[model samples]
Target: MIRGLYTAASGLVAEMARTDVISNNLANVNTSGFKKDRAIFRAFPEMNIHRIGDPAVLSPKDKIDPKPFIGVLGTGSMLDEINTNFSQGSIKNTSNPLDLALTGEGFFEVQTPGGVRYTRDGSFTRNQQGYLVTGDGHYVLGLNGPIQLPDGKDISINRRGEVFSDGSFVDRLLVAAFADQRQLLKEGDNLYVSNQQPLPSNSEVIQGALEGSNVNPISEMVDLITAFRAYEASQRVVKANDDTLGKAVNDIARL
Candidate 1:
């Protein structure tokens, strides 16, 4: 009975973590360049049940097998990891020349408080210093460094992520790719850091466009419902175990 209670409690905790991931995906359905998170779980090792009884002295010729192969049992499960899906999102055109979007695998370089960071959010703007920056004022890096636009000249980002003004090349955007994307760590605020080997650039930029969030609302809703049901079932199991324990102690044991 006690084991059953612990198993149900573990299930409840795992379901709660799944619920959090689903809710976060739903909440970021409209966020630009946002990736969805998935919850992974693994079962814990099973406990060994051994028989306890008095044993008499055995004869010299008699022998007994101390260990026998019992059926495998699961104690419980826990959240193993949270995986990030880097699938491309749909692009929307805003017609703003400074806005850019990557059509393939890549990440835009941005100067953040924690040094250089990477992002897929290409929605950029010119700051007061005439420098291209993200919506949150992170400086956008280019081949030569931070890209600075010319005054009163219309800025255009070509398919090669080159910044041009009056048909003259000003700077090229620094786009980077990872050989192993799973090694990248999410630092929040639409930024990621990677320690894996960098891959050759293969992404093209499209000006006047923005990448949409990768979250699918319909899928997230379905996941939310499943998590809720699982949590509820675990709660029922816990309640049932409690009732059985109560009866055993107060009624059966008393009788």
Candidate 2:
């Protein structure tokens, strides 16, 4: 009975974790360059049950009597790590000269206060210092350093991430990729940080374009309903166990 109570409790905890992930995904459904997260679960290992203090149970080789194999009992399930899906999102054309998007796997390097961060969001603009920066005003890094645009000059970014001002080559966009994308950790504001050395990305730069979040609202709603139902079922199990314990302690003891 205690084990059953523990199992039901674990179900509640796991469902809560799943709900958190789904909620976060739904919240970021409209966020640009956002990637959806998935919650992974694992089951506890099953243990073998045997009859105690029985000679036949200990000695199964004896033909006179044989030990019986009992059914397995499940302890509970646990919530594992949450994995981010790095799949490409839909590209949207805004006709804004500063807006940019990547056509393949890679991230744009930005200089933040903390350190260098990476992002897929390409909505950039020129700051007061004539330096190219992201929407949040973080400096966008280039091959040499921060990209600077001359005032009153038309800007053009080519497919190969080369920036040109009045048809004069300025700098190359520092787009980078990692061998293992899973090593990248998420920071707030759609930024990512990683310890792995970056590799040259083969992605093409699309000017005046931005990427949309890859989250599917319909599927996330379905998952939310399922998680709520599972949590309710676990609550019922816990209530049932409590009632059983109450009956045993009060009613049966009085009898």
lDDT (Cα atoms) of all candidates against the true structure: 0.89, 0.93
Q: Model 2 TM-score? A: 0.92
Candidate No. with top TM-score? 2
Residue 230 lDDT, candidate 2, scale 0-100: 99
Q: Report the error of model 1 at residue 51, Å.
A: 6.9
Candidate 2 lDDT, 1-255, residue by residue in tens: 888899999999999999999999999998888999999999877767655544544445554334456768888899978899999999999999899999889999999999999999999999999999998999999998999999999999999999999999999999999999998999989999999999999999999999999999999999999999999999999999999999999999998
RMSD of 1: 2.7
Clashing pairs in 1: none
Clashes of 2: 0
Q: Tell me the tens digit of each residue's lDDT in model 1 across 1-255.
A: 999999999999999999998998899898888889999999999877654442433667765445544566679899999999999999999999988889888999999888889999988988999999999999999988899998899777788888899999999999999888888899988899987766667899989999999998998999899999999999999999999999999999776
lDDT of candidate 1 vs native? Answer: 0.89
Residue 84 CA error for candidate 1 (Å)?
Answer: 0.9
CA error at residue 42 for candidate 2, angstroms:
0.8
